[model samples]
Target: MKEITPNNTNTTNNSKPMQQRKRKADTLGYDLNLATSSGGETAEKGGDGPQRRLWVKDRSKDWWDKYNSADCPDDEFRKAFQMGKQTFDTICDELSASVAKENTMLRDAVPVKQRVAVCIYRLATGESLRLVSKKFGLGISTCHKLVLEVCSAIKDVLMPKYLQWPNHESMSVISDEFETLSGIPNVVGSMHTTHIPIIAPKVNVAAYFNKRLTDKKQKTCYSVTIQGVVNANGVFTDVCIGWPGSMPDDQVLEKSALSQRADGGLLKGVWIVGGCGYPLTDWVLVPYSQPHLTWTQHAFNEKIDEILKVSKDAFSRLKGRWSCLQKRTEMKLQDLPVVLGACCVLHNICELRDEPVEPDLVNEVVDDDDDEMVVPEVALRSEFASKARDTMAHNLLHHNHAGTSIL
Candidate 1:
């Protein structure tokens, strides 16, 4: 028997550049309405395990052809995909090489633009896969498979370009903006945690239960957490996603790669302001959590809150733009991390490009309650960090560090 080798493979079993493979009816999401054409082909019968009929079906993708006929109405496109045409083009261009597949005997490889559109629209609308399948003229299984495929490409290809830790110069600029926003010095980012609802897993179901959220919202809930640190301009710089929702904010912080970086002195002398959910530390400058606040503490909370709002608003837009994260999703439990990571990366891109959320877009995902004043999971404060809060409070109350004096 001849062994299967690359050179021995059939000539027809090969991938082609999209430019070379473009056909008349091949317009999936691309704005190419060159002309209308269609063709059909037969596939070789598979191995003789069991004989079956050919597997291609006739599904009409009229919706894509109609709306995608022109450049696609800018407002309408953004509403459907959560991004404008330019942003969509950029994603398709970047992920094409990675997402484009080889022509199969049974069907042509899904087009790059269509693959991205399917995933983005599903995420933006949170519609069921059945609907997505009907909309894109693909099998339900195909739509689900493409979502994960394109998401993996985004994480691999676009993440490094769009999402990153700032350079030294960028960090200095971030610190300056934070200082101007609040009296906090050397603060590079604002941090917040948001939750995404997921279907309960069969095993270890209790771990994923969000008791705090369930108790407060009066709905049985299961979720995974996404902890984001955003810069002054509301772009995510770092994210720790997919932790069990039951963990406290401090515990999530303790387990993050960001925390590990801090342990290596990466966070020395800098602060990332967060809500009361985080205990004040050398690097984490949270608001005063005292039962009774002094005048200075009151002033400090008011000012520092300005920084925390940056983080909260960033996550709010994240859930708003990617409606899939706003509610229970059809994605499987194991596949959510890739999906959420893609959303964060895309969020940064949309923000950097100055894309505005649609006027009707609202944050459907419920925000977490006020942080419980969780203490630092470990002794992360030094003598300098311990005194840093007092000095910051006094300065906020009495010095020019504050924008205006309350007294």
Candidate 2:
């Protein structure tokens, strides 16, 4: 071995420490300048991967502007908004002032027309909030808020104007129309209940679960009932929604405000026709359920069928126009009622405006058979109502206007 000098020893010690540092750096993934130089050379030689563009162009503004332009054709407007341009403008004119007044104090608030348009598009198409937000160029949470706000406004303002209990004169007109349409006399309105499917509620999930098995494997679906009374024109005059699906139709009626009003003599002499799912009272008339019916009973049932068509058609038109009601809406259980109520209001608006119904929507209406709940003996014994039904049946069989055949 060579003799160890101080300088040599110092150099050897420094080299060992430097080598240990390099090894530690390598283990920790830290390059010792060689890798850095190699990377720089590769970049300069154009061997680096493609660079990603960071900025994306937003196209929502162009889409929205195209749809909302004044020169936009009426047909295109109808396709998007589900209403004619005239109707849309009318509604916007009515709602714009109030929406503007409400948003007067907020800076960077969305325009009223845009807000209303977004809400209507969401309701009309039943698109998801995320999709609608992307289409309208809005944040998801903002879209939800705008939808709720606009629906509340519609319920508050348009509902009273469009959907209201008919007064004496209005009832007379509606009754005359019904008689002309179906030969059903003294009919103020036709009543029916439809199930609006919903997501299972966090609270009282069982209450929302419909006892009627909707699937092949006996799986019960959840729904809420919307009991509506429509006039001969298929316009809803009275609506009672938010009832749990598990509740029977008669129970829903019994707990309804209409029932209370009818019981308190407020609806005295005003008769409304209901299906077999309802209890026959003096004000509410139902068809005879007994077997071996007479000619008069058969005639009565036929006329009742004709009258009930008004309600069925109304529901069809409603669900057709607002497809959201047809689907299981992804909304909170409590919020669903408001959304549905708004749909009803919009339905009446469309009907009053004579908006054309789509041909395919007519086939979408389901002819659901109601599971009749057993009525108590005491409740079924309505002698006066029974006599009223008999009298009407007798007249229908005898008169036979429009050559209505009982065969």
Candidate 3:
């Protein structure tokens, strides 16, 4: 058990610069007398642990050679992993151009392609910043800054261009989807409100949930309501995120910009289909769920189901049990719905271009006895639907059915 001690310096080699001083071999043992007498050095011994070598080193170049080979790296596979290849590359170029224009303030030492490649690599692979830095030969701070800046730029530059209906043609495509509901056959589309689960902000946790207290298990997480509408084909037409889940759907809807469409007499005679949550006005009601509701109702529901399924799978990274833990990161729960809208736009484009898949239908007969057990408001609303039934009945009996099927 010998204590480690600093080596003695030699001034005899003063002719050489201090920076050129060579380190000496280490000596082991407690006897200082023997150390001083025997040049403070010990014989090298072979052991199981890694050897402390003085000069030996490996300078292998084969790995680099292999990496450079065209066939070795599998560029096609790499391209596939990089989602939206051309689109992502375009954003990367845009970011570089923006940074270049700001060069009077600052300039980047890293190449634009490397910066773009690294940011997209981290996002697509979900790797840690430190790991990405090492892989990209970037400093940790640079890796973090580049990724954040690029993400912000990509969101700003791409969202308005790709995630929305830019013209009446796109709006018409969306409107066609909404018109698929049976009761509201002419209804352009339906709106549904969903939530992105979030941890209740510290002060609002207890008060955020409903007072009914029916089942705590079913209502554990706090969330924010995201209102969106999907067309008859199931493409999301409009999306508004950020309202707290504690708010009522109508309240959330009222605060939305889309609400102006309903209020400004924009939808007065125009056919807009929606669930029961929507009021019966100049717009149509899709019955949400009713027996007499058209087969289109089921078709629309099926589309919604597919969209949500794909969305959940696509952004599974944010699907946390609690909102607080999720919010602490760069991504927000509200962003999920925005991302979902983008996916819908992509889905619509894909559907329009791709050939259709053959269908498989399932048919089952319901018992007449099941009808008796249900109530009429539920039944009439199901069969003819409240909006269609009421509108037709009132028109025939009162106003001579002048505009019964205008939608």
Candidate 4:
């Protein structure tokens, strides 16, 4: 109050707070360099201010070194990649031709082996893209791009070689195997559909929702159904996927390319055994569902049940080997079919190579109860097909009772 000048008054007012801040900084052992560098004006500038230093250790070299080292054991490799070293090498060799590096000056592209390993590891283990990226020492975008690219490459190159429908000679051999196993003659393959859960789609969300039971908890989940045809040895011969979960199995079958092929008489002489969820047709045979069953129907159901186990086993081993299919996949709606098809291709490869399935995986069950049987909009049954079914059933029953003494 006694002759206080403007400059002196302002200095006195700021002195106490500055002293207090200096004392706090000293007591807290704060890095004076951080404050001194820009004088804390950046913090006052708010969200657009300079970012703090973030130290991220690059572990890509670690993964690359371990993968390339001779010390990495075969068991470790199998556990990480879900395939033996020989199988991995075989895949690498096969995919190398297709997924080879592109000549680009902008940073070297990932090597073929590393790219294939990333995709296979993601599919085999169903790990998140972030985790797979970390494990492979790649950026998340890099991992994502590589996975889809490799999946496309695999589907394009290997589908014909590995996941094709059996030829006439192969169909004969497969039919013989089916007859030996279940006494079902002329059975080219067994067909079944399983649901693969997915995230709620942005468009047509209701179409993808289906009731599912998990841990005995009944809940509506979004899923897509995969209808597969497998041989007697649990090897997939045909796969039709990307159908909505809300569609019945029969309806999905009716909309499938296989159905079109059958309709065009491409499958005239061949019969595929299916469950009760399918429509009875000359090319596709389903077991009887009525209560008062005849001996022929009973015998036919028994043999069809045995043959259908191949499809069940195929799906079980498929989801079991690639556990990703058992859970809700994080893939985009459009990209899911390709990934699912890639899994089937890999499953066929494993089966063809005689890779021993895990003992626990042998008994794994795949749930096919998503959709109930609905009478198709268009009548799928014909007298000719019904007569063929009845004739087959009768023949099976007669063959069984041929050596018996019927009084």
Q: Assess candidate 3 and give its lDDT.
A: 0.43
How many steric clashes does model 1 contain?
0
What is the C-alpha lDDT profile of model 1 across 224-311, one tens digit per residue?
9999999999999999999988887888888999999988998887888887677667688777775787778778888887898888
* Model with the higher lDDT, candidate 1 or 2: 1
User: How far in Å is the alpha carbon of 162 misplaced in model 2?
Assistant: 1.0
86-112 per-residue lDDT for model 4 (tens digits): 887888888898999875542356788
What TM-score does candidate 1 reach?
0.84
Query: Which candidate number maximizes lDDT?
Result: 1
Ranking by lDDT: 1, 4, 2, 3
The candidates, ranked best first by TM-score, are 1, 2, 4, 3
For model 2, the local distance difference test gives 0.76
TM-score comparison, 1 vs 3, better candidate = 1
Residue lDDT tens for model 2, 1-407: 12222234445554666556656754543423321121122111232442212111222556678888988998888778788878877877777756653333212467888888888888888888877876776656667888888888888788889889998899999989888876767889999988888878888988888766365226667899999999998999999999998887888898998999898887777689888778889899877777798777877888887888789789988888777777778888778777888889888888999998786875775534334544434455478888888888877777774225756
Candidate 4 Cα lDDT to native:
0.76
Which is the winner by lDDT between candidate 1 and candidate 3? 1
Clashes of each: 0, 0, 15, 0
Candidate 3: residue 291 lDDT (0-100) = 61
Scored by TM-score, the top model is 1
- RMSD, one per candidate, in order: 9.6, 13.3, 14.4, 10.6
Q: Compute each candidate's TM-score over C-alphas.
A: 0.84, 0.81, 0.49, 0.80
